[model samples]
Target: MRGRLLALLIAIELPIGCVTVLTAATAYRTIMGDIEASQVQTTDDFAVRMRVWYRGALRSLLSFGATVSEAALPPELCGQAGLKMLDRARGFSAVLVRSADGRLCSAALDPGIDAQVLERTAASMRASPPVAPWKGVDLGAARYGQASIGDRRYLAVHAQNPAATGQDMQEALLLVAPAVLESVLDLGRGSKGMDIALVAPDGGIVANRGDTPPEAWLPRESRPPAELDRWHAADREGTERTYAARTIAEPGFYVIATFNDPHERDALIQLAVFLLAPLATLSLLCLVYLRAIDRHCVRWLRSIETAARSRSSSKRARAAMADDMPSDIRSVAEAFNAMVDEQEVRQRRLQTALDDNRFLVRELHHRVKNSLQVVQSYIGLSKRDYQDEARTALADAECRVHVLSAAYRFTLADGEMQPVRVDLFLEDVVSMIANLIRRRDQWISSRIETAATLSVDRIIPLGFLVADVASRVLRSTPGARITLSVVDLDEATIEVALEADREVAHQEPPRLFAGLLAQIEAVQSGPAEGRSLGRWRVRHHG
Candidate 1:
């Protein structure tokens, strides 16, 4: 039973475990995926802002390039108009020009001499075909190959001006500044605990208003991804950082941004509170449910067991006869109680039957004894005035009657109307026969053998038949020795034999007296007949 209970518990627990694991896994994956997708979306937004701002800056450079190429004035006047105009343009790093042959002609920067910077810008333009001539050009002798004034960075559009006779070098120069990109990056920051920046693909600082230079904000090789991608990495402080990066065409730079672990701490706390609050409530509910089950199920089972044990040891009827008990235990109690009831009823009935039978048997034995004695008196009375042979026959009939009475007496002694032992009945019969013949001056010795049991119905007739044969044999020769006995013939038959006494003189057996003969015939269906040892013998079968 304990094993069965344990199996039931395991069956319930396994499905609960499976459901918990599957639900947790699905929720965690879905929440993390949403977080990752939000990060990517934020980066794309930042990149789009930067793209718009940088495109404006590039248009500024292109306008300056067109004005410089269209200039038709003398070199000195062109220089004054162009220099004044470039200076008023905010965040221009330098306004310088190169001849179409790629030489510095007139310049606001390095007006006296230029060699290395122009050559480098020319070489860069030659190497990059897809980029505009303004791309990657060094405008002045800035150490980063560009100037970051305020938040804008600049490089020249062309290494050389158009070689028109008097074009100003100032108008030919294009400026790249970090300030425009920085403004865009700052707009994205918006006081959020996140970093935003635009980085050069060549690892140059393009624009950043972040707390640190964009390159130093993350690992050395880390920059905005060329397409939309997001990832998780550790910051220098060893805290988890999730980031998204994308490349923008207008800035010609990578826009990279990150969400700091601190930035997500509140969201995590809120999520934990959300998840844990309900989980705690559910756990309490589960415990309460289990307690209820124990109260209702386990306690009920224990109560049933207690009731069963009480019933086992108590003699009284199990309380209420268990009519409405749980089906499992009800059957056993009912069957046991039914057997007890049946046994008690049967015992009472048997006791009453036995007492009544005893009374009847005793009464029967008394009445039958009186009747046989009366019969013996009648035979004695009848013997007077009768012929000697008739008187002797009457005595024989009386003795046979006594033999039947004795057999019934045995039945009464057994105290039942049931069968009597055949062997014991024959023993009594033999003794009676021997005694009767002795009184008649017959030398009779009897031996009886039998295996058939005689019931009350047959005991009287069987004994009367044996007695009649013995009398006839004794009378066949007065003063003769006779042997009388019974033996089993089969399941349904008994055979009795009587031999005349050899000590008696031989004589024809006296004809059976009419009345005695008729009584013998009624029981045995024939008269006793035959002779042995020159003396008569009689045989009767019952």
Candidate 2:
């Protein structure tokens, strides 16, 4: 009897054990998935914002490009051009313009720059683009700006403004600065608690976020995806993160966006485990109890029946049956039946919930898509009446709205963003901008160096800013070459330069542009500045 009872107990407990283990596993998986999804969404948001700021800076610079290009440079105007470049040196650590054949045009050196060394730097600057700072022709040992303007030997990263294709191949605009500063500024460094950086493929930091000491930043080494077997990484302060990388539209560059947050998949896993564990435990206990009842009560009842059959039938037989049959068996059976009934009810509720949740998810997707379309419509309408400067502003606003829509659409399509690939995101942005620019302007020729791609986070502002600058320059300088180049100036930095005509004059004195450049410098937590000529040199039209 005892053995039968024990068997019943064991059976009751088996279900509980199974439920516990299964619930735990399910819960863990769900949570992990949620974390990944959340990370992706967060990273996407960051990328969008970063792109916005970058655009602002680029626009300010483009304004300068346009104004400069329009002016017809005379021998006298070259000095003013040099001075104007020197004044606009707020975000840039250094500004130097060189001719196509490598002659120094105009330059503003940051304090401690050796005039002699700068001359040497200028010579090397005239050389073809260096494949890498270390591998390229040395401009002689010179102090890099970050370590000390005069203390550390550093290589200069160069940028150029070329005459529009087929116009003047021999004329070019040159710019050079410390690669580290440019990288830091582009990462949106001034925002407190936000750590942005560029990491080399070999696990070196190209630049630390502005404001944070290099030592305080974590080493690029010892970061994530133990189980991922070679996945790109994005993490927050040692916690798990979701990140995406895209090669910069610029050749030979990469950009990444990262975020740390919980994903929906994690919630699903938690819900599963929460409900499953208790049910399994109850099932296990019930099985054990049933086993005990079977051994002690059912077995005894069977024995009594056998003995009664062997004896003469009478009241004694009935009495023997009553005495031998364990009442516990009836009690246990009743309870088991009650439990099965309860489980059936619970199952029905679960099914209803699942159905409702499915409906809700579908509805959510629909609403998000509608919302994005509406936003795009609004921006388009607003852009219709604006012109000149106002048009530029409107265009930027529209671009941002489009970006927001893209974010939502991306999420809806994937159910969540994950391991966000920055290059892909940037490629989309570039295509969109290029199409918009091409479609919008028939008179002015605009070229997008779609070849350079940056992380989506970086792209948000950088792309827009680049476009804005180009547009402004095209508008201001009617017949000037505008070349936009993005290249690694060093292992840890990237730089952009705009060179336009020295004689180009703005309808307005560009006081506002100057101020804007200052603002960009302040916010970027990096060096930046601007200058404008009061007049342009002419052919002495008699």
Candidate 3:
């Protein structure tokens, strides 16, 4: 029972655990996939917005470039044009116009630089935005560049301007501060924890939100990715991140977006908790249910089982426990106790009735023996008045009475419930008969080869018959040997044999003993006169 209950609890709890784990695992895949896709969309939107911002900024910068390069502009005219450019476009922090010979001819917004920044900016702009190389007095098509001037990052647009001096051309440089890129990123960042970067083909970060350069985010992605590619890679901190790349301004620039990986595991854990709490509560409730059954039912059953195992017939029975039990259990205990007590009471009454029966049976046997003895006494007294044969007849009658008396004594007083054992009755009856005729040198031997018993009524008559036959045999042939036996032939039958050896002429059995023969169902197969005699045997039910 204990094992079954434990198995039942396991049967309930195991499925709950398996389902929780499977559900969490499946949900982790599905939800994380959605989260990754959402993050990719974030980067995509930011790339689109950055592309739009660049187009407007480049157009306005180009218009200002046209203004300055309509003719050769002096320092004052360049300054006024640059100030107006700043007022028109908040994205522009400063501007520089330099001649094709690499001399700084003009500056705006209190710019604190030599001309070397513009020269290097022009030299690196060849691949991106497809700008041509500078020739003597003729700079190629316009292009944008991201450069560092004195540790500060700037985005610059450079274009050729028409100059009156044939070998002299003009180059325009526009500087954008880091603060402007940050504001653009703010517009694209959503609830998703996203990081974005504008990357150049030279493995340089054009603009990014974090301190780590964008190319280091995926060291293997230093080469340009195809348009709108997505992959998983590790960042500079040796942690994995999901990255998506979109070509924004192609000739080798792209927008790279990374899904924040540090938070992924934590997010999955939170989702698992959201699914696990209710199931955990259900598991706890199952435990509580098992506890309640033990408290209310199983404990009571255990007590009843203990009592039942210890019950004995010879000793008083133990009652089932009932104290402080639930009403249902108490009722069962009460019924069990009542049943045990009733059986005990019935057993005691039965024992008392048996005792009473023993007393009555013993008294009856005693009185019966006394009556037979009195009859023997009267026959012995009557022998005084009889002659030889008559006196011998009287003695035979006296011996038969003595046999009847012995029969009564051999039987049990209190054991009247069962039949008399045939062997015991034969032994005692044959002994008494031999003793009664001992002076005649006659003795009877008796035996029963198998076990059998008979009712008192059937057994007492056989004793009388055996005693009378032995007396007659001794009278007819002095010193006769008589033998008696009862043998079991089968479960339902027995054979009683009485035999006497005779050296004299054989005599017939007397008619006077016919009544005894009929009473015991004993048969006489011999003639009334002289007959050969070796044995007298009877077969009957055991």
Q: Compare the candidates by lDDT and give the number of the best one.
A: 3
- What's the residue-level lDDT of 248 in candidate 1? 62
TM-score of each: 0.47, 0.35, 0.53
What would the per-residue lDDT of candidate 3 be over residues 360-462, giving only the tens digit for each residue? 9777878888999899899989988987788778877887787677667666545453566778778877776665554457667877786676666767777
Q: Which of the two candidates, 2 or 3, achieves a greater TM-score against the reference?
A: 3
Model 3 quality (TM-score): 0.53
Candidate 3: segments with Cα more than 4 A from true spot: 1-38, 57-183, 186-194, 211-237, 240-253, 257-354, 365-426, 433-542
- Model 1 spans > 4 angstroms off: 1-38, 72-79, 99-173, 188-191, 211-224, 233-240, 250-252, 261-286, 296-301, 316-542
Estimate the lDDT of model 3: 0.67
Candidate 3 residue 249 C-alpha distance from true site, Å = 5.1
Q: Could you arrange the candidates by TM-score from highest to lowest?
A: 3, 1, 2
Report, for every candidate in turn, its global Cα lDDT versus the true structure. 0.56, 0.44, 0.67
- Name every residue pair that clashes in candidate 3: none
Instruction: Tell me which of candidates 1 and 3 scores higher on lDDT.
Output: 3
User: For residues 38-144, could you state the per-residue lDDT of candidate 2 as single tens digits?
Assistant: 44443344434433433333333343334444443442474467556656654444334334333433444455653355555555544543222222343222211
Q: How much is the lDDT of residue 391 in candidate 1?
A: 69
User: Can you write out model 1's per-residue Cα lDDT over 1-542, one digit (the tens) per residue?
Assistant: 44465566557655765666566556666776676777787778887776555445545554554465456444576567556765777655444444343334333443322334444454554343222222344232211124333343454343332333443432233454446446556644344556776665465656555564445456434644647777777665555666678866423456777765443555556556665665666567666666766654555455545655665665444423334465654555566668767766887899999988878867877788778878877876877768676766776776778776777677777565656666787777777667555555655555656555556665666566556556655665556666666555565555555555344343444454334434433334233344543221223333
